[model samples]
Target chain A: MTDIRAKLRGFVLEELVYCEDPDTFSDDEDLLEAGLDSLGIMRLIMFAEREFGITLPDTEIEPDMVRNFNALTGWIESHRQ
Target chain B: MQLLEDFLANLSSHPRSCCLVEGGLRLSYREVAEKAGGVARQLLTLTLPEGYPVAVALPRGIDATCAVLGILASGRCYLPLDLKAPRLRQRWILEDSRAVAVIGHAPWNDLTLPWITIDTISPTPLEPLPLEMENLAAILYTSGSTGTPKGVALSHRAIHAFSDWAKELVSLGPEDRIAAIAPLHFDLSTFDLFSSLSSGASIHFLPEGLTIAPSHLTAWLSDTAITGFYSVPSLLSFWSWKGNLSASPLPDLRFLLFAGETFPTARLRQLAGYLPHTRLYNLYGPTETNVCCHWPVERETLDSDHPIPIGYPACGDRLYIAPRHNELWVQGPTLASGYWQQGQLHPFLNEEGWYQTGDRVGRNDQGEYVYRGRLDRMLKVSGHRVEPAEIEAALLSLPQVIECAVVGIEDWEGIRPAAAVVMQQDEAIPTIRALLKRTLPTYMLPSTIRRLDSLPRLSNGKPDLVSIQAILTR
Candidate 1:
């Protein structure tokens, strides 16, 4: 689970949040307000699914599920078979 | 409805009919008319000029709709400011438009303009103000190449003509429910708001943040039973790529209208497969000219990988192609009156009354106008029109930035703005980006910024954009 959180943080910092410094981004920071647009969200979902070998349910794709690093890691962990 | 005033007047006959839906809130024609009338009465007390501009800065909801209708009812042109846009850009527009007042929830404390809070206004239905067809209706701002945003000033006549055409083309009726997915500032909302209201159709305003979630958006479309859908091709493409459209077919959707950017043939074909019963149209136009040409997607035309043609003219518009460069020119009632800049109205149409759309096109064997490319360096990033010059200007505003070149970088999603900057110090990149965020919208911001010692220039000392694009990609 810790490894999964690290990977998600790295992907978001490098791809989604372009202007934010990775060192300063808190674990609970709102990704949506940090410029995670629709395109970025779509790409992030795809990346998570591919990286974790788990399918994130489309119906659960709400703001709360991917609001931060902890929420994203938890969502992915629950879906992993 | 021939005039915008007629839309509200005709609503009296269907007083009990549904007019707008946002989330769990639903408004009838009578309720909407009364609220909008209250807004008009508030504006009338101020005694503004006949065609004075009023800025509307509010979230996308029922109140925003009422504010626009109220402004229109007051016989003043409404300038919609996207609340999600950068504050500095919104301020620039408000300053440039010379708005007399802002109809919003809270007072714009920074600006000295009068604010009319919507919730505080009491309902007092008033008759629509008497106005001529030539009176100004709305002013929409777009990215400009000269560093400042250009305001497309449209008259009531232009909107009526386009809405009449749209209403007839889609056969919109009182039973139809249209989705207002586009932002209020975008020209696409013209069809969603004006055409639907004129046709006595109910428009459902998709809540903010729902647009980013494709699955949720698809579910909403199905749950709401939306019959008429209009948006940019990029959004539809994204939904089709990720949303569960195949599993949950929208049987009630009668028409799907897409404009703004070119739709990839493959993605469009996939959409057709998913929504076999729905009609698809490729609408083509700039903000200067509201939907001049469109093509009804044919089953046979999707056989090849090539893009679809822009098809024949609509809205009583005539197309003229420049012989030398094949640039498309439009002349019709739908063309905007002119551009408003720095408190001056500059005529956009030529002496002969032809608006030159900076789009290049060629005639196919079937006489259809095939879209070739843009005649200028404007980049369409996910259906948002971005002028590289605007981004370059924002970069050059910083003191440390000596030179810069902004270009489009194509990736899996689509084209995005990328910049190559030659600055005195590399440490200023973050600060420069932060400053730019205050002036430009998120879509207009450069996706990648790289510092270079110098920009590649041509023999004439102009930046070689081709080389710059190669370097940015490499």
Candidate 2:
């Protein structure tokens, strides 16, 4: 899970264009409040699907599941086959 | 002036109709009129001369709308300074307009003019002042390439004519609930604020801080029962790409109008697929002429993948093509008076009283005007002039290319055309480059074709040229 969190942060900076330092976030910080918009969420979801082979449920992906780094990683860990 | 007077009179009659909604707060037309009258009475207390420009620096919401109408009722024109712009930019606009006062509650103690706080105002009945038809209504500043923003001075006569035409063209009525998506400073806001106000329709503003949140935005659209949507193409693309459009279609939406920038054909097709019931329109114009031409998208044309024609001239405007270069020149009552700088008229107007649009266009086989590119965007490469849009169109024809922006970068070998491309999923960059080499002419091919995750966009969602240049140099 720690490795997944680090990889997710790397993708957030490079692909999502977060424009923030990687070390600025804690595990449970609100990513949406910290400048992670829906555009970033979409990109991150696609990245998770491609990299980890975890298919996020298209209709059931509530915004709360991606609210923070911990929630995102936990959701992916639960869903990955 | 009579049209405006009648519109205000009608609003005063309909007291219970919802006039605006912002930040989870809704106000009726009667309440808004009274609030505006209160501000107008306060402006009278300031004793500023008629026709003076007053700056409104509030956020895009109900208070800002009331402030503008109040200033207009006080027989003074209002300038909306975008609060989110750089402080230097806001100050430059305030200095250039030489405004008498700024009405807002934002904390930045840099103003030399008088300030009127939006919170301190109280509602009172005030009679509207009589004004001439040619009185200056608003001054919208466009970003200049040379770093100095040029103010486009529009008159009451111009907006009245344009809004009257728009109200009829879109068949707007009191039943329409128009979305106020654009900022107050953008020219698209004119339609959102005035046209809806004139027709007694409700203007629903997306709440502050939630505009870019697609889930919240989609939910709000359905919750508010919005009937008419107006925005730039970039916002529409973002909504269709990232928002839950397919999962929950907005059943109440009837029309989707976009302007202020070019809408890529692929994105438009995707949106049309998402909302098959909604009618889509592509409006074209600069800030000088507020939406001169428009195209109503047809189902057949969407499949052809041809660049959408800007369509016929609306708002009683006349379009003339330059014989040599086919540059579009617009002439009509809707044209802005001129660029304002220190009370002097700039050279935007020609000897024949037409605003040179600087857009190169030509009539296609169907007798519709097709946009080629901007005349100023023409670049010379290898002693041959190449239009970047031509190259972009060719690249977009390839199945792998989803979006592309072509710009000219200066090198030791003079100006060279470079493309920043966003490809479809899993498509390789080299495939697009090889496809472009086979399809385009040798001189028209981009010297450097770079793939990007996304194009850097401005606050208004148009592609940022300075950022594109930075990427090219890097």
Best by DockQ: 1
Per-prediction backbone clash count: 0, 0
Q: Write the per-residue lDDT of candidate 2 for residues B361-396, one digit (tens) a residue.
A: 888888877888776776644323456776777777
Give Cα distance to truth, residue B186, candidate 2, Å: 0.6
Residue B418 accuracy (lDDT) in model 2: 84
Which segments of model 2 are wrong by more than 4 Å?
A: A1-81, B49-51, B343-347, B377-474
Number of the predicted model whose lDDT against the real structure is largest: 1
For B1-474, candidate 1 gives per-residue lDDT tens digits of 225554665587788899989989999988888888899999999866444589988776688888888888888888999777788899989989888899998686678888899989898885678777877888999899887788998888998888889889889988999999888888888898898988889999987777677788899999999997898877788688767787899999999999988898988999899899998888888888988998989967897999889998989999999887889999998988899887557898877779999899988999988899999999887677899999999989988799999999887667888999998865666666777778788888887888999999999999999999999888
> Against the true structure, whose TM-score is highest?
1
Which pairs, if any, clash in model 2?
Answer: none
Candidate 1: list runs displaced more than 4 Å: A1-11, A18-20, A46-57, A74-81, B426-428
Chain A TM-scores, candidates in order: 0.92, 0.83
Per-model chain B TM-scores are: 0.98, 0.80
- In the range A1-81, model 2's lDDT, one tens digit per residue, is 777878887776443433224465576877665545444565577778888887665444556777788888888888764
